[model samples]
Target: MDNKAVEALTEAEAKAELAQLAGALAQANILYHGQDAPGISDSEYDALKQRNALIEARFPKLKRPDSPSEQVGAAPSEGFAKVTHVVRMLSLSNAFDGDDIIEFDERIRRYLGLGDVAPLEYTAEPKIDGLSLSLRYEAGKLIHAATRGDGAVGENVTTNARTIAERVAEGRKLPDIPLLIDGAPDVLEVRGEVYMSHADFADLNTRQVARSDKQFANPRNAAAGSLRQLDSAVTRRRPLRFFAYAWGELSAPLSDTQMGAIERLNDFGFQINPLTALCDGPAGMLAHYDKIEQLRAALGYDIDGVVYKVNDLSLQGRLGFRSTTPRWAIAHKFPAELAWTHLEAIEIQVGRTGALSPVARLQPVTVGGVVVSNATLHNQDYITGLDSKGQEIRGGKDIREGDWVQVYRAGDVIPKVANVDLSKRPEGSAVYVFPDKCPECGSPAIREDGDAVHRCTGGLICPAQAVEKLKHFVGRAAFDIEGLGAKQVEQFYLDGWVKEPSDIFTLGERFSSGLQQLKNREGWGEKSANKLFQAIEEKRNIPFARVLFSLGIRHVGEQASNLITRNYTSWPALITAMDAAAACEGVEWDNLLGIDGVGDVMARSLVMAFAPGPERDSIDKLTGHLNIEDAEHPDIDGSPVAGKIVVFTGTLEKMTRAEAKARAEALGAKVSGSVSAKTDLLVAGPGAGSKAKKAADLGIETIDEDGWLQLIDGL
Candidate 1:
């Protein structure tokens, strides 16, 4: 967007832009930090953030609640144990151009009351585009290393860190400093970036492709994935290198100045950025930035930007911090790469829920550091130039087959079409039309009103939907059956060995008695087939919640299934309730609808699935073959909210309604939507009228969101 156009945006336009920026940044964070795969380039991410900051500055009052300005990296994945940092590892403010750096310096001088009389020195270093780590050393011996998760907390990856290189190996590389540095403090926390060099990254990708494994998106992602490995052996195989740029908690100070501290760190046998230098002022900083930018292509490792920090420790302390960033530093980011690729064709994939996702098959091209052949089209609207709100985007232009389009990947793992180069359009090209029918089963694919996706209405009858459902059934969140994946399920389905969920339990008996022996298959051995059968048999006694989710009922996700199971406690009780609810709209139906977040749509979907039909029959047959355990709720001993049905109404001031429900549920409470005779507590927020009055009239205990929080404070 042009500067004039950005300056002239209306309040509503700014607000809309902010929402889009927030969503994009959040998704980018998830891809970068959680999945270790960045969909977008660092420059693109920085640009988005810069745009968001500009918009927020323009209309401060219109700032969204989930602004990227207030956030750090994505929340850490659940696989690692979270380590809270004693001193917060805050992110730096961004600078897009030389003018931004000048402004930053001037702002710093004004804040410090220096009046440009004294030369304020700064340290400019290459900002490594890799995973951030904080290593703790006690008595100069390396203890633990953690990844910078959300700035305040991180994932403990000490074992993974050790796999990079043992203390002996690392110590042998540097004769200046031993494993135990002499006269070092009892405790020292050195913060740095863990990165994979370009050569190593390419070598790793080569090995990955050779082994037929999924190639990493980039060096940063490869480094992150390697460093966060639960298995140290996997990390040990990757060629990961580290560069110490800063420090956290320290028993004693290393040096008085930033450059001195870095020098001290280098002396302690840690790799520091070679480009690290002391800059006189903004001019020096810009000069260094330009030099680094020119050398970026030749750098052995990824460096997204150059970081400029106040050289003096005292000055940095005085400069202090903004809400989410430090005033003492800023990262000047580089530009993103864009390449024109031919859009060969568009393919549609039918998901378990029947949503048809469009994927663009493009001529292989390199964007940034990753090769791209496929990109997500999101939905039909995205291809035709209309957004989710039906707003005209890209001048109402639609992408076409055989057309040259600019593809770019920001932190997004999936490459996206930035723009279509219409000048190079293929002669006599026609607008690509989305399929109205499912390719796999000839089922009529229909788009529901207000929904962007086109879905196959054939349900279980569609082979595509059936296979997708079966895959989800045995997914990690579901049955998670060993030796049974999408490939295995498809094979079994083709061989008529498994048709429904019940068939999985009877596989051993079928193979033992039938003429078609399991060991006769090309890939099958007696032991392997027996192992598969044994795995299936072990999963026969499943949890009720897992059983409910494994059915692949539409709109009944893991959490909703858990809620239903907890409410019913048993498979029989839940089936009986669902069956009764399906017969007619009565108390049972209302009761199902009363579950918090379970509205008319989800309730209807559940009841329809349970209605007397083949779906119910299949579910019943599966249930007959399994010993399903009743739902177990954690006991909140001596807690007032335990096992009580609670309803929340209106806009909560202290917390989101979803958060409220989650907290209440965590405290062993059944959070419902509407006030009812069964409701033990009513959390009525401001603007709550009907539900509040109803609760009051029904003689139920009514409280505000704060009151509810107070009740569950200890528990």
Candidate 2:
């Protein structure tokens, strides 16, 4: 919401924005993947995702459990039978510019411990803008085809896929996908993209207009809808094509390198991209990318960007993967298109944090094949033609109503006003004025020092803030009550059925027996009402971390919740600790701060939230109706340092501080940043300061880097 650059965000601001981003992205995934319709442009979605990544990079410890960075696509549509992938179909990280590509190559080299001079080859190819499909074959015969639906599971479209293969076979040419291949592995799963050529897409639309059906927005959408049709007859009529670029599960190794593997797939009667080439390094990769970009317009189908992967299969194996993406590969996207549009008006929307975010209403214009009617104004600073630091931007040209502005969606996924045209500005136009009062609740909007945007002083009194908070409470990362979505939350709030989270638990008990029953409400029936009540009842017992995050406390994100709960183990323990730490000094405060990644700012926020007040009262009321489970402990049966509170002081020589902490945590150890009375072991390195002296004074066991390594050796 605050366009004040990712670098300017404090830990608290980043955490809050991350929560909002997670929810938005979750909805986007459902629209794009599950429903075969996207509400936002690809550039807009990419911008939001890129912003999420940037924030997480700056505040790694604040990364939420439901962070969009850890997710891919959406759950499979209910219409299709589910197919669980043998190997998860992960996505690739994106590189927007040449610098990003350079950093990507450098990161891979660093991860694999390869020198700059080392011959680390890479394979570069076009990144197809289409639906991902996995075709599984056994004994050289096509077994099934599945669409990538949320990475781990997919939608089975075997019948629809077979129709395409059959049609290709009837053409009397080499089939795009041979129903049977010779000399293939006993089991093979080829991964590719299903796309429609521009000419074919035009023809399909013409047919759709003749049939009086809804016209598709783009070729990608048309191809997806056609392939995912329940009736294979519908799919057989559509001009769909496949380009094999990767693999999923294999009975044996296809080749020693990525390019070789693609060649092998081609030999097995799959249509491989002819442009796929081996690049010597980053330079060659970029060169090939440029060539591909020049050829993109004439390629007949859609390609959003160029993909680069570690060519050597062994190197790729060594690079491994993150939670939802391969570490060895990245997509270098082409630059976004630019267009000019009129700034019709600006509207302010308040967030759950009470920050007033401005949105730009624009005259609808097409940019990059998508119609854009709106853009993000970010904040008052962005609208006023200055950054948070009071520096001039757009040559100090402030945005005004009735002005023509240049719009672009390159770095940021959200279309932004890049520049204002002074010559085209209306004669009567005046500089835009930001509001000093909450637009929704008439509360006084105040801007704090060092903050970029204005926040409403009103807490729950503001309907906008209250509704957003309620939505967050029922978010996928929080309580996650089934059948309780954002729309339901808003409807219930407007009807005054649910005001606070605790009120939700008592909805059935009070409303079900009253004259104004939920069953009789508009668009509701007894069965649906009963199902909603049952879903709400099921969430009465929730995990401790979810409970903490569900409260929507400032500076407390999913990771912070996990860290605090893991330390205290139970709700009562955390409450007791917070009560003690409210004094702001002593062992309690130190203990709270000692938790790795929990800074003074976050500690203060936790203490304030738990102090006696309306916030604490609400939390108490909510907890009364629910069973709060203890924090889950990792399986540490064979771990040497399980349940031990370990601290690292000064510097770590063998590994980075973060790496050391991660390794220690993997072995079931609590890696604290500061040394406290509860510290079981201290791994002190060079320049060990007050922390080392305190550990000695407390008579805690201290060890050097070598000793620490020796202790965990062979574990």
The positional error of residue 704 in candidate 1, measured at the CA in angstroms, is 6.0
Residue lDDT tens for model 1, 576-609: 8988898895989888877765756567878988
The lDDT for every candidate, in the order shown, is: 0.79, 0.83
User: What TM-score, over all chains together, does every model reach?
Assistant: 0.65, 0.83
Model 2, 549-625: lDDT tens digits are: 99888767666788899899999999888888885558888888888778776788789989988888989999999
Q: What does the lDDT read for residue 423 in candidate 2?
A: 97
lDDT for 565 in candidate 2 is: 92
Roughly what TM-score does model 2 have, to 2 decimal places?
0.83
lDDT value for model 1: 0.79
lDDT of 2 at 171: 34
